[model samples]
Target: MDTLCSRMLLFLGLAPFMTLAATPPPTHQFTLDNGLQVLIREDHRAPLVTSHLWFKVGSADEAPGQTGLSHVLEHMLYKGSGKTCADEASRILESIGAEENAFTTQDVTGYHQTLAPRYLGVVFELMADLMSTARLHADDLAREIAVIREERILRTDDNVDAAALEHFTALAHFANSYRTPTIGWMHDLQRVDAGELRHWYESRYAPGNAVLVIVGDVTLAQVQPLAERYFGVLQKRPVPRLLRPVELQLPGERHLTLHRDVATPQLLMAFNLPGLATAKDPHTVHALRLLNALLGGADSARLPKKLELTERVLNHVETRYDERTRGDSLLLLSAELTDPPQADLDEVQARIWQEIEALRSTPPSLDELERARTRLIAQQVYARDSIAKQARELATFQTIGLPWRLLDEDARALAKVTPQDIREAASTWLTRERLSVVHVQKGGGR
Candidate 1:
């Protein structure tokens, strides 16, 4: 076991976060009078604390033509509030040698900060003001919109792989909101105004709809009072779930071919799978997670070993599956063509399917499954080293309508996932009907 830990630390570059045998700190949960949810994890290793305030509204919650409103609002929140003006909140945190940032995703918008434990009250006061009494100044919104436009161009428009993935996501889901990009459409960004952002913020960012997660150098007793003093006074409002159309299980595979100016071709294969929120059979989510790891979670996984090392057809390959979502999740396999180009995309696709077939037809050895489990468990353990990451994990689970306790149970579930579970998951979920194949070919002027 010690040898495996050493190897994983070196192989994964996780040595800095590795405290090989230490257990995670206990996490406590509470709800305020105004319906604000609070989660506190006591980590006394350092005198620093990380706090995450997550709202259950994101790009998926936006109506058509108002996409990216959530992200724009995230940026504008930094511009000012009643107590802080024009980046004053950031300046305050920076003055205290703290780090702060926020992100907008498909299902949530999170604002986070890491600072000395004594500054916990300061962060809470600033964030509470931003949440309830934010000054969505029109000028600030205009400037932030411009910044976001450039962000969209740099991140998606000019970047070939990102553009291809955007197109692929659109083609893959019919009624699911995941089809919408988090950055939103370029035209929508042009039309979104301050009034729209204010309405979006008021309608979504409420005490009832937010979760506050704190980790590191803090006790529940210390945090509960600060949380109540700053945030508990806010009035709770009704934040209804946005009604989105259900994704129909349509027959036939979806394929997209994009032409871009690129040095090497790329292939992306994504299958729509059930997430923690959508899965009817609970164990399916864990099984799919393990299957993803076994396929491409590491350099030693099947895809890298065969395609990159043995077949020499691809230079890079990776698989991604996130079960913590309010909607259906995507299990993605992405690869890049080798330099000098080995095989055409057609042959590469065939070889990829052959590997999937191998897992579907025959189960893996117990040793193979155990290795994948160990890799996943080790990654989870390493994540605990960072208070920010720890808080985010708790917030994500709670915001997605699951208990944070699921974090501890995940390893046990993964351990119970047998070889038969792997075969069944691959055979059931990795099907043509569920698959979306996207090819980014070398070309220009598309």
Candidate 2:
């Protein structure tokens, strides 16, 4: 442990933004009478400010039949609003040398603007109008739908890994809305109309359900007045509570093979796990983070060292653990198998399973555990350097109903994680019955 910690400290000393004592902490928050939450972080090192707005509604909150309504509305928000034309908003921002964009995820939708301090007023006005007074035109909706369809075709239809991942998620959770793609099923998108999109916009885009996060070369005194002038006038609505469906407990192991025409064979193994917000113990989340770091996170990780270096059975290997907004999460391990004889497939599967089983039976070495903690801490410090990343992390925590401060706590917690906790979490969650294995084969049709 001492050697691992020392190595981590040495690495942190050399990496950018590792000197946390000099970094400013975010500290201001206020709520409007209408229920909009506002958070402001002051950093006067630069002459620019980043304004971010987060809406709590996401795919999970969409109406049962309207699978991709949240995402569709995200596109519609930019069509036109109030005095702005379809493309006028972009032009307005560009004229001021500002950058703006929006994205929708499983649990939240966000819009952000980064510009010189002089354009802060412009940023606020544009966002407020888009959020409150967007007028969706019929012709614009038609054209945007076409664009979105094309995006889906390019992103999912033509891409092998994207298609496989989409299918895997859909089959992984039976009752959860996470099963649905954010872009929505093609059939659902085709059936969505302008009226339905408008209704979704009005219902979910309420001021009460939004949060305003501003970070950069400004203070609360200067920004709060501007925020009130532009956003405070918006009326609030009765924001509906998010109702998440319960996912049935996995009774046994589930295996799915999705064959696609691809250049290489890909294997994805996922296990059901608890999310950060609802894990049996908060330490479980930290342990899982460390465990993933040791397994497939770094170039020196276990799977890469074993598969790529020794066994030579895989060309590439990686793992990801998503502590999603929902209480149910997934631990995914993917590998691109080497070109081998047909008889070698079973051996490859056995090797991967053995690694998983080993984690459950034995704890990670003292060195491996320390290295993982250091890397995780370094990531947290690095993330703080970008205003956009800081905003997103803060918004993600708030959206998931976790304390925004947990961002810091999570990093610290990782440092305290012990080997025993990792073994226990693996034994508890990564069971055969709770796992889903997906195989993608070349030249094999669905």
Candidate 3:
């Protein structure tokens, strides 16, 4: 994740005077009678268009026993639809020289296609068909469940680092639905039947609960009618009330340790924080975003600079935070031990606390602050170079109940994030009550 930021920082430092595009291609928005939202941006840079169909529901919307139902439904969509056989949609896309894929996250699930302008309507037709009349056969459900279980095994169960993160996240939140992994737990996958899947599809996969974003060499005139002819015709239905449980306040830091079969030792520290949509003070959100970059989002950040490079206390370190989420988010720091440890998690953690205390006590230098901001700006500028990223950014804002214009406000808001603001944010949010720590080492059971 830091690779792109590192490269951008290097380029910016060496170039001395490099400029990105001043303005992005104009974006247009409209809503259908059936309540489906559509946003289109015309980028004639290439004869290709990227379309993303996004549903606002994800793992966070699922009930306790029905964890991963949203992700499983995403899989079943590719299995078959009213007009296409199992995997036929993928085959059709391949035949048309198009690239297509789908993903499920904590707050959104999206299916996307990048194809020649001539194939725009065909892709929309496929997505609309899947939305309205996906064939959730019993046999397909059983098979896909097995596939999902295998996927969990590979992504979470077999990987020690990922498993540690999973356990940490679960312990971080008690009532918040985010405690559950997006791929879901192994036991939850075993009991999901076709009926439950069909119910989830019918309830959550409605036009009212979705957003369609198209970017590239396509005009609103060309895309709008295609959207109407396919997606507009689908009947809108009531979606389940998104009951995102608030995490009750905890007294102090929550800690856990897991011993797994791994050579490298791992450490994770997370501070529960409000995301963009949930924050009462938007400035704090932007400040935290900048603080993340200063701490670990970049190679030149404090964590890697002080610990990994200078002190040799750790070999790697990075921070993870997502402000686009619908509910609370985590400011996470993950690190691994050096080859022959002169320091353990206790020593590394103490050093980390010292750095945090430094930030809380004193503001960063103006030059250091500017570098972090520039890196974030470069990331946004690079993201706009891809149509898929542009579409996703638009859809994500819409899904999270924010206007796309908020993206335009980002640079201005981020620029206003003074050093004092960063220090204040760190002091206010990174508290012991909001913290969770996980330690992983080589061995058997905890």
As for candidate 3, its clashing pairs are none
Candidate 3 per-residue lDDT, tens place, 233-303, comes to 88978866655445656536899989988677889999888888888889899999999999899889999
- Positional deviation of 283 in candidate 2, in angstroms? 1.6
Off-target runs (Cα >4 Å) in candidate 2 are 1-24, 244-246, 340-344, 444-446
* Model 2 lowest lDDT segment of ten: 14-23
TM-score (all chains, Cα) for each model: 0.94, 0.93, 0.94
Tens digit of per-residue lDDT, candidate 2, span 1-446? 47767777755653443346234486688888778888887767679888889998777776567888788788888778997988789899989998889899888889999999878999899899999999988888888888888888899978888999989887676567778788887778788888988887887788888888888888888888988998899997889776553456773576777779867788887877668876867788778877888778787888899988887888888889877464577778888887753324457778877887899999987666766776777778877778878788877777777777777565556667888888887778778877877778777674
Per lDDT, what order, best first? 1, 3, 2
RMSD per candidate (Å) reads 3.8, 2.6, 4.2
The TM-score ranking, best first, is 3, 1, 2
lDDT of 2: 0.79
Candidate 2 is scored at a TM of: 0.93
lDDT of each: 0.86, 0.79, 0.86
